[model samples]
Target: MLETIGINPAELAASETLLKLLISTALLITVVVVVRALSARYIRRNVASMELRRRWLVHSRNGLLLFMLLGLIIIWGEELRTLALSVVAIAVAFVVATKELILCVTGSILKAGAGSFNIGDRIQVKDFRGDVIDQSLLATTILEVGPGKLTHQRTGRMIVIPNALFVAEPVINESYTHDYVLHVFTIPFKRTANWQAAQQALLASANEHCASYLAEAKRYLKRLNEYRGLDAPSVEPRITLQMPSAEEVHLVVRIPVLTDRRSSIEQSILSEVFSQQEFSGAKEKALEQEGSAPTG
Candidate 1:
């Protein structure tokens, strides 16, 4: 009859295999259901504590379901292998077509296994910086953090970054400490400006504004260091001078500030430095000198 319908031997064999698989699956499910029911009844009768009885029933049901799954897999293994072998070329093509999707899923798995970052973490991946707002298997959504890293201001934009990038790039967590962090920012000045005075002004401003939490930051860092087995970095405000070009000076200021208040604290320090008499006077003098200098 199969031959009359144009079904070849291979097709007939596959049909038989499928039918057997279905029957076996149904039988396995039925047995699992019976066993689970019996186990639950036994547990209810034998177990005195309600919690323990509930636990036993849950565990038994799970075990039975797992057993049924394994049984189905075993019963269908041969048929599945044959189908896979026949579709080797198709499978290869499918995989090639969905390579990026596969990579995204793999990257998600890697992120989960590594526990790299979580929602609300301020993370930087390659050129992207944002506060993580949502995470899915394929991508992460962030509330954009900056037009530049130093700004510490949200751009009011949402960015979706593919999880695959997490596999390819390192993620920097700016809020790793979750409370306070040592923030660094640069202030550029002309070489002719009173760099010493500017440095003093910046340092004084940093110290004054950051004084309330300096000790706390220090203690927190020390505790973190002990917990993580790392050397504790200083929480004290410090200024390092750098010459980036022939006529420019960069005063790098490092200070400990609360993570959420980074921008406000930085702005306060800048305001105080710019408002200082000595620093402003020096800046004016430098500008006058530049205006008076000979030019071609």
Candidate 2:
């Protein structure tokens, strides 16, 4: 009859496969529905507790669904295998053609899986440091945070970074503490200047500026450590001396500050330290001497 209608052998085989799959699927669905209904009725009648009845009904429905799924897979196994091979070939070619897009998506998956950072969290990838403002599958948008890290000031520009960079580089999460963070900044002094006095002044300024929230930051860090099973670092203001060159001494200061107030707090500390008579005395003397000198 198919031959009379001009259907070739290959077309006949394909039509038979489709018909068989459809009929088998319908029969499986019908069987599953009957079994589910019967089992639910039996469970309700035989089970004493409501919870047990619910559990049994759920298990029965799930088992029936699984059975139907298995039956369908068996019925269409050969066709599915052929389709899967074609899909694999297409996918390989597509990946090769769009390798960067694939990498960006893969990076997004890695980021989501790792719980790396979220909107409003400050993150640094290579030289790009900013607060994450938006995230998409292919890229992340951030408000650029610095001319350099030490400035801790926004450049008032938005940067869209490809998500693929996350896979290739490390992401530094600066706001891991959420509310507050141990912020570090450096104050460099001339080796010939009153280095000891400058150190004292800087330490005093930090202590004064951070005194209000110092205890609170310590407690917050303690709780975080306890929650994460980590050893807590000291939150008290610290100034460590480092001599990077013969002409300079860097007084590295670390203190706790609200995540959003890092730049302000740093500015306050620097202003307070620099305004002191001890630090400004040399400049004042130089200015007075210049003024007394004959006019050019």
Span of 10 residues, lowest total lDDT, candidate 2: 276-285
Predictions in order: lDDT = 0.84, 0.85
* Per-prediction TM-score: 0.69, 0.67
lDDT of 1 by residue, 1-296 (tens): 76788879898787887787789888888888888888888999999976456556655765676687689779988877878988999999999999999999889889879988766779999889998876766888899989987789999999999999988899899988877888999988887667788898788888899888899999998998899899999789999989999988899999999988989999999888887655434766778889999999
Q: What is the lDDT of candidate 2?
A: 0.85
* Root-mean-square deviation of Cα positions for candidate 2 versus the true structure, in angstroms: 11.8
lDDT per residue for candidate 2 within 1-296, as digits (tens), equals 76888879997788888998899889988988998898889999989976456556655765686688799899889988988887997878888999998899889889878989877789999999998877777888899998987778889999999999999899999998988899998877777666677788788988999899889998999999899999999998989999999988888999999998999999988888777646535555667789999986
For residue 178, give model 1's deviation from the true position in Å: 1.9
Off by over 4 Å in 2: 1-84, 87-89, 278-296
Candidate 2 clash pair list: none
Clashing pairs in 1: none
RMSD of each: 10.2, 11.8
Instruction: Identify the leading candidate in terms of TM-score.
Output: 1
- Model 2, residue 211: distance off in Å is 1.4
**Considering summed lDDT, which 10 consecutive residues are worst modelled in model 1?**
50-59
